[model samples]
Structure formats: C-alpha cells, structure tokens
Target: MSALLRAEGVGKAYTLRGKRVDILRDVDLAVRGGEVTALVGHSGSGKTTLLHILGLLTPPDSGRVFVADTDTSGLADGALADLRRTRLGFVFQSYNLLPQHSALRNVVLPYTGRGADGERHARALLDRVGLAERAHHLPSELSGGEQQRVALARALINDPPVVLADEPTGNLDTRSEETLLGLFRELADEGRAVLLVTHNPAVSEAADRVHRLDAGALVAEGSAA
Candidate 1:
C-alpha cells in the first residue's frame, strides 16, 4: 500500500524563558494504509511534539507533511483546518468529550453536515466500540474505558483515512487498554492508517512497527510484533 501520511525532515522548537528548546529534528516518518505504527518514548522525549506535527495540530518550523497525497507545507490556516477536518481523526489521552453531551451526541458532532444520518452513524460507531448500551450516557456517567471508547468512536465518525492517537490508553486499566487496542487493530484492518504515541510497552506490542524517539530525534525503528 502507498503511504497515507508522510513527514520528511520535520523539526519543531519552542522558546522558553529566552532559551530555545528543540522538540524534534529531522524526523522522517510514514504510515501506510492498513498499518499501525507506534511511536514509543519516555516523557519529555518529543513524542507528543511529533504526533502534533503529524496531526497538523501544530506546524513544524521546517519540513514537509503530506496527508492522503496533499502537501500541507504551504496551506493557509483555513485550508489546513479544512484538510484536518475532512481527512484526519484524533484520539487524545484526556478523552476530550463534551460533558454536556451524551455518548452518541459526542460521536455525532463530527458528522453534523451529514444531515439525518449522523445519529445513526454515531450509534453504529458506538456499537463497534462496544458502547451501544451506553449511547445515552454522558461522559461523567461512563467509566474511563467507556469514555475513551466514546472518544474513539467520535474520532472515526468522519471515517478519515488516518488516525492520530496520543497516549490513548494512558489512563485505562489493563483490560480497558486491551479492548482499545483491539479496536485499533480493527480500524487498521479496515485500511485506516493508525499512528499512536504511547509509552506503554503493551500498547507498542500491538503495533506492526515501533519507532523510538529520544532527545528530539528518531533513534530506532523496529518491529513490535
């Protein structure tokens, strides 16, 4: 399969108290359709920075990023936002669900333009994540795992080709983590490219390939399975 996402020589830096702090440098990465690529690293190791760049949440100081054959280097803010909304999915560690919305409503938020079928699609995604019975529950009423599942369903509601997950199972129990990993595998099987940033070895084990980062650079790439 061809690459669904690609990043070449990407770099990001931030200024802290008049000092330059480099987050990532010369990073080259790619994710093909139907693959799960795990980025593993310790805290403060630029994993999240790399993920943010890959997801287009933050632009790199220098480098080229392409998603689904579109080069994003010179896109304006509005155009980039449109690309992100239409072609990408995100799952964060915090779940990030709206407290006021039910599980189904949270998933439907991404499909507002789909008219009447949004709710039905949301319900189906919830069922896929094993949360059909909890569809009406609010984020606060659900377990951490259930909340994460809702978030995952919301991420997929758009049916984007690429999913970027940042520490997605960081707060879940072992069993919950296992369930989420299974869902991720299913997504990959359906030809979605998954790039996940995780510190957990168990999570990395589920990936087909693992890339390790340290001190603002990719240090190792190997098979996790």
Candidate 2:
C-alpha cells in the first residue's frame, strides 16, 4: 500500500533578526497506514514545525508533501483547507477546546457548517475515548486528562486517514498518558497513520517507529524495541 503521508527533502525556514533560521532541512519522512510514528525532540528542535507542515497547516519552503496519494504542493489555499478539514486530524497539548462548549460540542465543532453527522459521530468518538459520561461537561469542569480525551474524540470525529498529535499527553498524569497511548495504538491498528510528537519515553515505546530530530534534521529512525 502507498504511504498515507510522505514528505521528501522538506525544508522550512524563517527570518529572525534579519537572519535566516532553518527549522527543518532536507527531511524525508513517510507514515504508512497501520503505523504509529513518534517524533521525539527537545524544544526548538522543529518537531512542531514539521507536524504543521505535514498537516498542511503550514507550507514548507521546499519539499513535496503527499497525502493519501495527492500532492499538496500545488493546491490552492481553499483546496488545501478543504483537504485538511476532511482528511487530517490533530491533537494538541493545549487541548484548544472552547471553555464554554460542552465536550460533545467541542468534538462536533469540526463537522459543523459542513452538513455532516457532527453530533452523532462526535458522540461515538467520545464513547470510544471513554468520555461518554463527560460529554455534557465543559472544558473547565473536566480534569486535564478528561480534556485531552475530549480532544482525542474531537480529532477522530472526522474519521481522517491520518492523525497528528503534538505533545498530546504533555500535561496528563501517568495513567492518562497510558490511556491516550492505548487509543493511538488502536487507531494505528485500524489502519490509520498516527504521527505523534512527544518527549515522553513511554509514548516513544508505544510507536511502531520512533524518529529523532536534531538541529533541523532527522538524525535517527528506529523501532521502539
């Protein structure tokens, strides 16, 4: 099978203080269906930058990004937005939930205005993440772990082919981290590509492949074992 996501010679740079700062350089990466790929790196190592590029949230300076067999390099802004909304899921460390919205609403927001089964699908996802009971609770009323689980539910509501998580369990306790990791593994097993950026060793161990980024380059790639 073809890779669910692929990046070749990807490069990203920014200008700071009148100097060019390269965040990623000549990075070649691929995530096939039914695999969890962990990206491990310290702060400022460009893990988030790479994730954004992969997710189509940011365009790379020089590279080719293919998602589900479509090359995104030539897609217009509107086309890219449409592709991202329908084909990709994202989990972030911050949760990014609206404080006033209930967990169910938060999860369904992605499907809103799109005439999709926003509520029904969102509820099913919440059940999958073990958050069915807390579906009516607001973000502030839930614990960090609960919020993250809700985020996970929200991410899956679109039934995307790939999920990108950035520090997904960064603020959760050990048990919560384990729960999230389990969900990730399950997603991969179901043939969805799961790419996670994290510093947690436990997260790395759960992945089918782990990659290390240093100085804006991919320096290592290996299996958890």
Candidate 3:
C-alpha cells in the first residue's frame, strides 16, 4: 500500500528558557491506506508532536511532509487548511465533542455544505459505529467509549482518506479498548490510512505495524502481527 501521509527526515524543536529542546529528530515514516500503523513511546518522546506534523497542525523545522504526492512545505496557511479539512480525519483521546450537541449533530458538524443528505449520511455513520439508537443523546449522557465512537463517526463526516488518532484508547476500559481496536482494524479493511499514537500496549499490539520512538527519534519498527 502507498502512503497517504508521508513524513521524511522531519525534525522539530522548541525554545525553553533560552535553550533549544528538540522534540523530534530526523524522523521518517508513512501512514498508508489499508493499514493501521501504531507509534509507541513513553511520555515526552515526541510521538504526539510527530502526529501533529503529519496532521498539518504543526510545521516541521526541517525535512518535509507529503500528503499523497503534494509536498506540504510550500503550502500557505489557507491551502494547508483546505487540505487538512478535505483529506484527513482526526480522533482525539478527549473525544472533542460539543457538550450540548446531540451525537448526530456532532457527527455532522464538519460536513460543510451538507446539502440535503448530510443528516442521512451522519445517521448512517452513527449506525456503523453502533450508535444509531443514541444518535440524539448528548455527550454528557454517553459513556466514554460511546463518545469516542461518536468522535470516530464525526471524523468520517468529511470522507477523509487518512485518519490520525492520538492516544485513542487512553481513557477506555479493557473491553472498550478491544472494541475500538477491532474498529481500527475494520477501518484499515475499508482502505483508510490509520495512524495512531498510543501508550497502551494493547492498542499498539493490535496494530498491523508498530514503530517505537525514544528521546524524539525513531528507535525501532516492525510488523506487529
């Protein structure tokens, strides 16, 4: 499979109290369609920073990021925003749902210009995630797993080819984590490029490929299954 999101020799650093602190160094990786790629590391290892770069939320200080064949280094803020909205899906550990909105409404929020069938499509996605019956429930009324599933549905609202998830199973119980693990695999089966940053061993262990990072650099990588 080819990469939908590719990072090559990427590096990032931040200044703290007049001292440069590197967060990533000469990193190289790809998140390809039809696979679940897990990035694992301890806290402060820069896994989330790398994910942010790949997701176009942050720019690398060195090297390049490619969305499909498009080199992102030269794109302006507007172009980058367009690409991010149209080409990528994101899931977060906090679920990121609007507190007052119904699950159906939250799922449909990103489908700008929804036209006549937006709610229908959103309903279908909710059903796909096994939440059809709870479509009208507020985030406060749902379980953590349910809210995350709703976030997953929302992420798909734009029909993005690439999915980026940061610590997706971080807050779930074992059973819920397993359920999400299965869903991630099914996402691969449906041909979306799935890149997830996770600390949970179970989450990484279930992935098709695993990459390990240490002190902001890739230390090891291999097939996990």
Candidate 4:
C-alpha cells in the first residue's frame, strides 16, 4: 500500500550564532497505513523537527509534505490547522494532559464532535487503554504510564488515520513501554499509520520498519528481522 503521509526531499536549517546549521537535509519518508515506522536518531539528528513538519506544525525550508496526494507546502496556516485536527493524532513524551481535568475529560477535550457521542467514544477509548476505572482521576492522580495512556486515548478522539509520537515511552518503565508498544501495534492493525520518533532500541525493534538518521541525513532504513 502507498503511504498516507509522505515527505519528499525535505530539508530544514537554522542560523545559530550567524552560522547556518542544517537540521535535516534531503530527507524522504513514507508512513503507510497498517505499519509502525520508527525514526531512530541521536540527539540533534532532527527526528523531532521532521516529525513537526510531517505533523504540519512546522514547515520545511525546502521540499514538500504530502497527505495522501495533496501537497501541503502551499497551504495556509488555517488549512494546515484544519487538516491536523481531522487527519492526524499526536503523542508526546510529557503526555500533555491538563492537570485539572479528569482522564475522561482530557480524552474528550480533543473531540470536535457532539458532546454526548464524544463522551461515549472517550469512555470506550479509556477502556481500550485499560484506564476505564481511572477515568475520573486527574493527571495528578495517575502514574506516568496511565497519563501517557490517557494522552494516547485523547489522540484518537478525532479518529485520525495518521499518528505521530515523539519520545512517547521516554518517561515510562519497561513494563509501561511494552504495554504502550502493544497498543501501538493494535492501532496499526486497525489500519492507522504510526510514525514514532525514539532513541530506544526496544522501541525501534517493535516497529515494522526503522529509519536511522545522522548529521542531518537519513543514513539507513530496514524492516525488523
């Protein structure tokens, strides 16, 4: 199957101390449905930058980003925002939940649909993430794993086909990380494309395909053996 999200010859650079430093150069990647693609790179290797661009939160200095067949480079910020709301999901290392909100509330916060149906879906998602009993708990009452799971459920509120995760397991223990990976696999199995950025070997091993980056360039890529 073809990728639902794609980046072609993408490049980005920043000026630091009057010197130009390339964060990414000529990077090409494809995230297809039913697969988890892991981007593995060292610090400063531009993994997060590439993810931001792919998520439409940032634009590349050169090249183009494609969502299905639509070129997103020329899109205005409002268009990009609209596309992001409907077509993408995001998971972050910090979980990004509101401290004052219940798990159910946090999950339902992203829903752009009707409140009644959104609550029902949010409840179902909390159950799916193994947090149904804790649905009323606030972020302060949840463990890191539980909070991350809450964040995961929130990401699905819009039923986005593409999910982007950045260091999602960086704060979790081994057991939590394993559980999260299992959930990710299930998501892909359900026909969503998952693009994950990580520095963890276990995370990379769990992916269907792994991409490695170095010094602003894609260095290697392969399927898990």
Instruction: State every prediction's TM-score relative to the real structure.
Output: 0.97, 0.96, 0.98, 0.98
Point out where model 4 deviates above 4 Å.
none
The lDDT per prediction is: 0.91, 0.92, 0.93, 0.95
Model 3 per-residue lDDT tens digits across residues 51-120? 9999999999999999999999989999999888889999999999999899999998888555858899
| Best of the candidates, TM-score | 4
lDDT (Cα, 0-100) at 77 in candidate 1: 94
Q: Kindly give the stretch of ten consecutive residues in candidate 3 with the minimal lDDT sum.
A: 109-118
Off by over 4 Å in 2: 112-116
What is the Å distance of residue 167 in model 4 from its true position? 0.7
Clashing pairs in 1: none
Full-model lDDT, candidate 3: 0.93
Give the clash count for model 1: 0
Better by TM-score, candidate 2 or 1: 1
- Off-target runs (Cα >4 Å) in candidate 3 are none
Q: Lowest-scoring 10 consecutive residues by lDDT in candidate 1?
A: 109-118
What would the TM-score be for candidate 1 when compared with the true structure?
A: 0.97
Model 4: weakest 10-residue lDDT segment is 106-115
Model 1 ranges off by over 4 Å: none
Q: Give per-residue CA lDDT, model 1, range 60-82, as digits (tens).
A: 99999999789999899998888
Q: How many backbone clashes does candidate 4 have?
A: 0
